[model samples]
Target chain A: MLENKDPNRTDLRELGEFGLIDHLTQGLTQSQPSTIKGVGDDAAVVDIGGKYLGITTDMLVEGVHFDLGYTPLKHLGYKAVVVNLSDVYAMNMQPTQVTVSLAVSNRFPLEALEELYSGIALASRIYGVDVVGGDTTSSNKGMILSITALGFGKPEKVAYRSGAKPNDLLVVSGDLGGAYLGLQVLKREHEVVKVNPAHQPDLGAYHYLVERQLKPEARKDVIALLEGLEVTPTSMIDISDGLSSEILHLCKSSGTGCRLYEDKIPLDPMVISTCEEFSLDATLVALSGGEDYELLFTIDQKDFPKVKGNPNLTVIGHMTDQGEGANLVSRSGSSIPLTAQGWNAFQGE
Target chain B: MLENKDPNRTDLRELGEFGLIDHLTQGLTQSQPSTIKGVGDDAAVVDIGGKYLGITTDMLVEGVHFDLGYTPLKHLGYKAVVVNLSDVYAMNMQPTQVTVSLAVSNRFPLEALEELYSGIALASRIYGVDVVGGDTTSSNKGMILSITALGFGKPEKVAYRSGAKPNDLLVVSGDLGGAYLGLQVLKREHEVVKVNPAHQPDLGAYHYLVERQLKPEARKDVIALLEGLEVTPTSMIDISDGLSSEILHLCKSSGTGCRLYEDKIPLDPMVISTCEEFSLDATLVALSGGEDYELLFTIDQKDFPKVKGNPNLTVIGHMTDQGEGANLVSRSGSSIPLTAQGWNAFQGE
Candidate 1:
């Protein structure tokens, strides 16, 4: 009875990841009274008794998300859990538990799976969350990991992407572009190893960059910091897909515009030096390079004093009226419209 | 530093599915006070205020879990959600929400995904659960679906697999063996289609079996019926890995043995007749057939009167002392040990 009604089949690549999710989930309406937020958010919020529970899930596919040739199974497991927890942290929630599900082919031995789970367990212990449950099964090809993170937050303390108001200060925790550059270093090393099997390359100089890519720490501490400072972000999102894409998400959801100052964007000395060596623009990398796993948020102008001059946070820009549009004010005083040049799995594959 | 400690790579098949999960999660311990149960349960139970929340996840891999040649995308999507909801129901919790994640190769078009989401939405609507959040990405080969179901129940009313005591009556909802028989018919028809293309084989006679395989429903109605009858099960589980395997799990968790009566095993007329047609043993099929999505539970002897003569449930056996061991009494009066002949994704590949 479920025949293809349309004569022409539309290619999935025609609409990118965000567009595809939006198209498919357009008709779904929440019927459960407990479901506070369903789709179109970092995490779905549900009211369990008086507490607000945030639930988020993420999937990592082999070849699509990672390559096992260089990526250790343990790090892959740790990063997979961190990716989901980042979403919960983005909502200003304290993560309590996670459910990890995996699909692996016969090529993965029992020892390999054990190594993967060790990393998962380590992450669970470090983050103070319980590994409550999961499902493991055989896949047709390589490994696929899907994790669901559950966290809780007070009703008033929870943050959302749609809560930003015009004139709020845009804030970010930690530096950007390191993770993306780290991946570049790994990919280059992998290519070298492919050509010469016995090549022993010293990566001492790129230790920081490689670690950023391999083992990203989700900003659970930032959520706690915000609570300690008595500052609630007006809007918040995790920087999984570059700064440009995340800024657009907050602006679109909050029905506002933003002016991201180029000079104010946070960057480490290592990122600048590495970008110079690679002949890449540091600002462009920070704007378009993804997988930072840092929190990008906005707070009311009155709360600026709380985060001002804080090393953990950078005041990158400020929100503006919808008519002003989202733009990047370059150091040279040029107004450039921000575009999502972040990694799109569907495109350029 | 995450090097393989063992020189010999042990194949995953040596451990099997259940063994792999147990071995990997062996070192994990619950530190969260909210986490009531973890790892080894139908669903992990967490305390949210005074309410109990149950979380469960399941993964379905193409080629391994299903063959898309005959399986419709819509049915696959519907069944994925049902599989997870069944776990929540096994904990005697009311499913509140679900997150459905998908990883598909470029072979699937937008229409295919839309068809799948339609099924997901349909199932969500019917089950009274909100479609929360999910992740969709590209896969290396075939499609992979992972679903997480969230449910809620009263603290005192939640059932666990370890609560069964000796003398408690074992019961199951719905008949067994239909889904397994349905798969056999489909496989036979698939072979016929391969041999003679364009051959129109009638499937009208096997409609019930095929439906049982393609669109089996979770026991939500049974949960409500038990509540209406004021009968709360002491221990419960879902029949996903067949009666033999589920009975063993209940026995192992509760430290009790079970005496399953073969004559009391429920079977449909179609199932019995089809077993004869296929030259298979009906009792064996019923015992080892998986994917029934039926609820199996143990109730106190005092509560037997509440469920007695109920068409939705059948008293099949009773829990016994741990020394007795789990055994099934044959119709001819022979007590045979119950072996788990259910599908093992890791073995026989």
Candidate 2:
């Protein structure tokens, strides 16, 4: 079925973008009836309970999204599912199914994809999310992964990004910056290995940081925590970009600002030491380093004591009025304007 | 900022799949009032409508998902959004918003991205959907598009793929197989051009076929069409993988079987000629060429004439008893078992 097309040939311009997607998604296996509409509409329609439904998507690519050389196809598959479920979790909903679409180059053997799907299946089982639909094709380059996780959520219980207010105590689950440090350490070790191919630097001590970088966890715990604590956040967002940038988003969307105490910022000891070792700013890591799957949320000051100082919870900051602006109050009583940096670095990259 | 290193690079075998994802999306940026939970959990939670919310993800890779050498990014983006929307739409609801994620290598310039987004933005507008959230990253090879569309449907209006019966008519909106033929023309042109670059083939003559390939529209119109016709498919699916595959899906899910008449298969006249010119079977194109984006659905037989001969619809087949099995009866009274040749081609590719 390779069809004998020149591997090094075929300009994408030969087919318009539409032609390409059509060719790729062609012969897709559309599997369900709740999929009232699929693939060829403004939005695919689903029927969940004939009353409410759910929708979410995640994107992954080679190089920018994943390093094929360093990353295993299986974990990449698992992470793809995890990423989409993160959104579903953010919505306070449960997922039922997912549609996966992939792009691959010939560099990947059939064995490679099976490995990827193995991880996808495992994650699907663990999360109770089914792989119901997807698209797959070859790429001219490395690879791409796009998966849409569909689930059921009563519309009345759905969450939006715009509901935080002043006096809401800002809290985050788990410590921060360990993942960033993990990246730093991994990058450093990778460099060393490149220069000295035989150097067997055992990074056993940095296992947590390294693992945090390679296998991220979506905070299914917070949902359990919220259930256990019997408390609900007024507003919330995920920590994908970084801490400071996320704060700026809450402020921008909720018509409120924040006041952060430098001393109060939670930092994993491993993250701190790694930052020091690299002469990198740990505070900046907490603020701008991306990819920590923790939850940043605001609860009424009334519920503060219920979770405050609890394990896995941190009093990182407090919400303020828009006029006050988002600021960080230092240990010395100085306040600095909060900056949004996550997206900027990406834009430059 | 391109900080790169990791000891794992020294021993590829040491870096397994799970380890890589952890490294890739670790230390995510945290923000927003609606995010109750994020990456480190079963699912992320957001606040919406004064209720807890959920989000999930999907990533569509290149070659594995679509053939960019044949697909235009514009339609690619539009279809990307459509694919995500289908999952949500399957719940029988209205889609409210979407976030598109894309990975493109330097092979694509800023202008190329602009075109892709233009289609996405246009589709968003057409669907009354908003581009509220997303991710954009770099890829090492081809362009990778991952789109997550967010939608809301009242619980009652949402439908599921699980609810069909033996008596259902198995209806579908819009004609079938034009997009398949569109590819035949495009591929022929591509081969012709490959052999002799100077030949300025008259593509204008193949308007409909070309349009079907490059500008395949989503059946957003079908949702409205059904509402106007005062008919709803008992079980529905979009014609993405070819009609036969979809019929089998409905049968398998409904625990029933189906029978269809070949003479009744839907096709535009141009598709007939195009298939003939290419020395391909028109039925084969309808059966497995895929990407029609039409709706394949089942309805009560009472609703037949109401939809039959509708400009956008065709009565190609019907549902049958479970023991009947899926079969296609030709105009000459010959019966053949329907085969899943369409989806099979991708696995080989």
Candidate 3:
């Protein structure tokens, strides 16, 4: 039996998500010769003979990650799979297979699960990954979905979070802040519906933001594009926890600092307009509003010519020596220290 | 944006766990050349060059799969990893890596999670598997643990559930029913403690059963023993959902029926005594008591000589023609049809 009244118990919120992970996994030695990298990357890299296998897992809880009041079961399932595939893609591997596990309460009917599975099936078909194996069980409350994605690549081509070097050009794929803005629109509409059951609010103006939040895509195409252009990222990570947080991750892992330009941060017109309507700073939203699911990487300065004119790729900044520290250059020309404002699940609601 | 008042919803309990999986994954098509087998097996088989890779996942939810009141955090963590590894071992593969994902509410303190992770670390060390990757998030209610295990084996040496043929001897590693009996003893003791909070039940008499319930091990040693003896099973599966349910799974996949001799069922002395004290039928307990975590396989009659006198294995039955149907040959010389009485998570508690 466990002691429920321990006086020495430390609150989980004190350490936050990343701190808890580090503290819990400290000194975990790997004995498998095939394990090339573990725990500290977007995906774990394992050597399967001559090739490299990338494995990663992600979990999404109903209340913490999404609200069924606005999020459909199909989209939730699709988003769950995409988020994990994004990790594999961040590792610069070709996504091949996934295992999906779900724990749901009795409130979810058979038809609801069917809807969820359909979205997973759609993602599998679109991404060309086989749904290999999984387990399903009942939970006492809301649904919890956990997905593990596996991908393969050449051992030499496998990218790690700790491979960045000073003077490398920092780049990101697609836009930022749209997914977070979309979530705001959905949550607002959900509150309105709760007060007025028959209300049907028009969302045409927020279409892009809503879609970005509900159906954000992983950057699988970016991996292929980089290969076609003959450019390999020195280090890469998926932007799930906002731009500033990811930049900090790359910096910490690679032992380098970065200088991100505020003007260079990509944002869709809808995201910009939504931020104005909500009276929020667009730059701050891009910096700390998580769940973008875009690939952020660094390329050698010499290789910049290959992606120079690519519309899908944007050069936002450059890596600096670790002693310089991570910072953002504001539009007013002042440099400010970058801090991780990423979503911490352990924080009290 | 979603309709919660749908009148056409079907209850999940209608189809049960296996039926739900079958229904959800009915038309999934695998386009990957490396995917040798997908779904409907203990673990998915993937061809990574000349070798086979095994991928499997399992989820454990609080109140459904386990209760923290009677289960120690360390044992819970260890059991979670062992359950997934059992599937890989059933496929005749050597587990090399695992990804453990946990979603816990703020109710769990940092110290509590450390105890859980310590158990997981111990299992990883003993099982010789690298803790490659995982995701941690906050759940709305209780804790949910999802683990994915990866293993490797020679393509030719890999065993499948569909490989059994007529006349193959059905063999099981270790004794049956102990784990189930162990759970019963724990539940009984738990009830006693609940009625009198200060009472500490002496469980010395039920030590073996309690250990079996609290710390069941996957038969990785049995896999090695089979290899050392040069015995390749015609078919193999792990007994997680009790003997009858697992036997049915093998029969369904292999397209054969089996003649399971009730008298031949192996039971430990403690299991039998515990069953007697509990006023439960030992045969029924062995038939439907789940979570045994023992390897069950079919071997050719010629290879039976290799394991004939092995203390670790017992030949309890023989595969029969599909027309024979699955039956239990009772010690009284009467035949009875086998029914799956495995624990279905969807069933009402």
Candidate 4:
């Protein structure tokens, strides 16, 4: 189903774990001030009524989620925290505390765990999040890392996935699908290297795409950018499961419709060219490719002017009547229905 | 290292996940009204300031913190939520919302997940906690689950782990060590079963002890019990890592020393006999045994009588000046130094 649906997709391990996270998190634009901090922290911290604190956590296990030969523990640790913070950041908050939980079999020695923690500690230090409380146990199988991030945010400022609105401008922070294409290039090269270890494939040619995949940064910049532009999204969600799914979520929650422009869909040049090389459709990749942690939000049209022309802010579309449905305008300007191809590992074998 | 610690501990699977969680959560008495809900829920729900809400979460993974063969996933999930609520309850707060994150390998079919979630869902329904949100994904190896619980309490009502005072009455809710002894019985049985497939041992003989090991419940009941008695603990923590380690945490955090009475320590008769049969000391099991989910706390000396005759509350010790070391009075009435036997999977191999 995934192959039939996401032909533009490449193997996840190609870009590697670290690179995939970095690529996905890049080009994000945050738009709230209560968000004293966003992604990159132990837990995104926010100023919640300037009183108490809130926290959330998530875990990712390899072989359970991704193949290890292709996934780096460092990137795995970093991405685990990133996913948790996305939820907190969605609430327009700042993250401060974190608890790192890791489970490994005898296969992982102290050094490997150290490598994973090195990334965790890097995230801790860089994001100013404290390692507060957690447990480390041995797994019966592969490696698993669970991260809980605590942040400070006002009760009123916290956003839920269910807050989109009709007539709200459908805005997305940063470019899309670069991470997906980056995976394609890395997977292609990985296959080549597997057949001939001596082959020094020049990934340099796809430097931008590769970097986007390897070091995906959470759109920490967007929080500041949105604040500077003086706009608050009426409803918001981080784009982890691709644009199509997220837009559908916003539309369903806000009881509205959306029409995305094919020409307006943001993409780096390398993504389009890479899609051509794979005979894949760039639009579909933009719609269904997962992993980008960019913010997809809906704002009151009145605030649209404030976000418009902002380098990081991309006005991908706008909300419409409920019956209009979620669709994308082709480059030639024909509307087409949108569908999600996000991985559901439990689906029929 | 584990050889001397919990070597006789049985595999968790023999108890199944549900049985294990029930063993850990038994007889935990509640003490506060704000804790409108406890242990059985998506999240433990608490009535904060009568209107506001507060939430927190934590996750545990096997291999990272436990061995599933010895740690039941049901008990793991139960303990996972218990530990997180212990944090908020430590704050004199109550849990209100919770989300559980789980990553499982195909090694576990949907039936396995159903059993795991049945406990979680049951806890939520029983405790009145809402399963507001959660993220589910595939794992590379075994299984890992993370739980986040949200709670609420008035600003003045919330208690912090650091709030214990010098000379506070160190009180424990419920008996200790059955969970540990239960482990021994299971291990013995497991060994027997492993050596002879045709042998169907008399499990009824160790029912009580096995139950404690297979299903440990949180001390949410103690929260209500304390409230009824009109007493409040100055500092609190749930027993997950053992009494010695937890008391030490309160002592160090509160900047005090402690004296625990071995004679006064509560132990189920089954625990005592099981330990003797296993050639292990019951006191050591009480000190190092984890998964009790009972509350270890301190209260004002004036409030002593309210608990003195209460079967649920035990005045096992008292806090002292930092100059005094953490010590335990032996059953023979001798003072012995206390040391943490908590498993350090990180200990250099």
Candidate number with greatest TM-score:
3
DockQ of 1: 0.68
Angstrom error at residue A83, model 3: 0.7
Query: Model 4 chain A — which ten-residue stretch has the worst lDDT?
Result: A16-25
What does candidate 1's lDDT look like per residue over B39-150, in tens digits?
A: 8899999999888999999999989988887888889989999998999999999998999888887778898899899989989989989999898888878789999999
Q: What interface RMSD does candidate 1 have?
A: 2.4
Off by over 4 Å in 4: A1-56, A64-75, A94-96, A124-131, A150-160, A165-167, A192-202, A347-349, B1-58, B62-79, B153-167, B191-205, B228-230, B300-302, B321-323, B346-349
lDDT of each: 0.91, 0.65, 0.92, 0.66
- Across B1-349, the per-residue lDDT of candidate 4 in tens digits comes to 2112343544433333323333433423343444444432222333434443444555566555555655555565555655676656655666655656777644554434555666665565555555444556666555677776656566655545566777888898778888777777767766887788777768687787666666666666778787788887787777777889888878876888889999888898878787888888888899998767688899989998888888888899998888887889887888887887654443432
Which has the higher DockQ value, candidate number 1 or candidate number 3?
Answer: 3
Put down candidate 2 lDDT per residue, B1-349, tens digits, no spaces: 0123443222222323223333333422333333444442212334344343333344556655566656777777776776555544443445665656566654665446666777776776666665543445556655566665555433333333445676666655656667777776777777887799887878898889878767766667776777788775676666667888777767776778778888888778888887788888888788887777676777778888888778777777777788988889988988888876544322333
lDDT, candidate 4, A112-207, per-residue tens: 555566666666556655554454555667666777665555566555555666677888888898877777787888788789988887988888
Which candidate order results from sorting by lDDT in descending order? 3, 1, 4, 2
Q: What's the count of clashing pairs in each model shown?
A: 0, 155, 0, 102
Candidate 3: stretches off by over 4 Å? A1-5, B1-7
